[model samples]
Target: MFVILVYDTAVERNPKVLKTCRKYLHWTQRSHFQGELSTAQYRALMAALDGVIDPEHDSIVAYTTRSPDLVESTTLGLPLGGPGEIL
Candidate 1:
């Protein structure tokens, strides 16, 4: 599976959230990540994040597809973080 994960959390919690996401996905930009993961990996990622975020104040979003080819992205300026643009 391919997953794109985005998160917004309090400043103090950023490190934990970012670390958790990086274990399973490629960081793409500020608060953004993407790449392939198995179903188990996906579930594990969520579980790890569950412990890091405050549900009432933080937001994490994940979009999944059967394959990476199913998604198309365009970056308009310099890449802000992560492994730079894939292309």
Candidate 2:
């Protein structure tokens, strides 16, 4: 499965969220990440994020699809790297 994950969290929790996501996805922008994962990997990523995020305060969105062709991405300025590369 392919997943694009983005998040906003309390200032104090931002680092944790970023760290966790980077473990499984590419850090595409300030708060955006995308990568491919197996069902189990996806579940584990969510569970890890759950531990660091405040459900009441933090917001997370995961746009997932079984195939990359389901989405098109364009970069206006400089481009980031492949799925797991850091900015």
Candidate 3:
């Protein structure tokens, strides 16, 4: 699957969350990441993020597509990537 993960974390734990996400996804923008992963990898990434974030103070949103072929995005200012590449 293709995943787009974004987060807003409490200041204290922000670095930990960023580091954990970098292991599984490419950091495409500030507080945003994108990549492809298997079901297991996605689950592991979520689990790892859960461990680093404070539920009451942090927010993580994941957008996913069944395959990279199904994903599409466009950037108006600076291009992030073309289709099939990480968004």
Candidate 4:
């Protein structure tokens, strides 16, 4: 499976988030990453990052798929709730 995460710059931007994600994903491009992982690995990675996000101005968008459809199917969503609710 593959995971794609998108972030907005105005709210918050952290290099650490990208650094951490690198352990699980291949840094495919700027502000975008992808990797092949099992369901369990993906879940664990997401769970590990639950507290590492800055929702006040930043966002983490995670999507999983068995095919390479991120470029064709990904859509951005408004950050809802508070920064703590970004998980």
Which candidate leads the pack in TM-score? Answer: 1
1-87 in candidate 4: lDDT tens per residue?
877766444323356676677788865455566777888988888776666776576667887778765446433453222233331
Off by over 4 Å in 1: 80-87
Candidate 2 residue lDDT tens string, 1-87:
999998888888888898899899977877888999999999999999998999999999999999888989998766765354432
- Residue 10 displacement (Å), model 3: 1.2
lDDT by residue (1-87, candidate 3, tens digit) is 999998988788878988999899987777888999999999999999998899999999999999988977767765563344331
Full-model lDDT, candidate 2: 0.87
In order, candidate lDDTs are 0.88, 0.87, 0.86, 0.64
Poorest 10 consecutive residues by lDDT, candidate 3: 78-87
Q: Model 1: which residue pairs collide?
A: none
Q: Native-vs-model 3 lDDT? A: 0.86
lDDT for residue 80 in candidate 1, whole number 0-100: 45
- The residue pairs that clash in candidate 2, if any, are none
Candidate 3 — which residues are off by over 4 angstroms? 81-87
Q: State which candidate, 1 or 3, has the greater TM-score.
A: 1
Ranking by TM-score: 1, 2, 3, 4
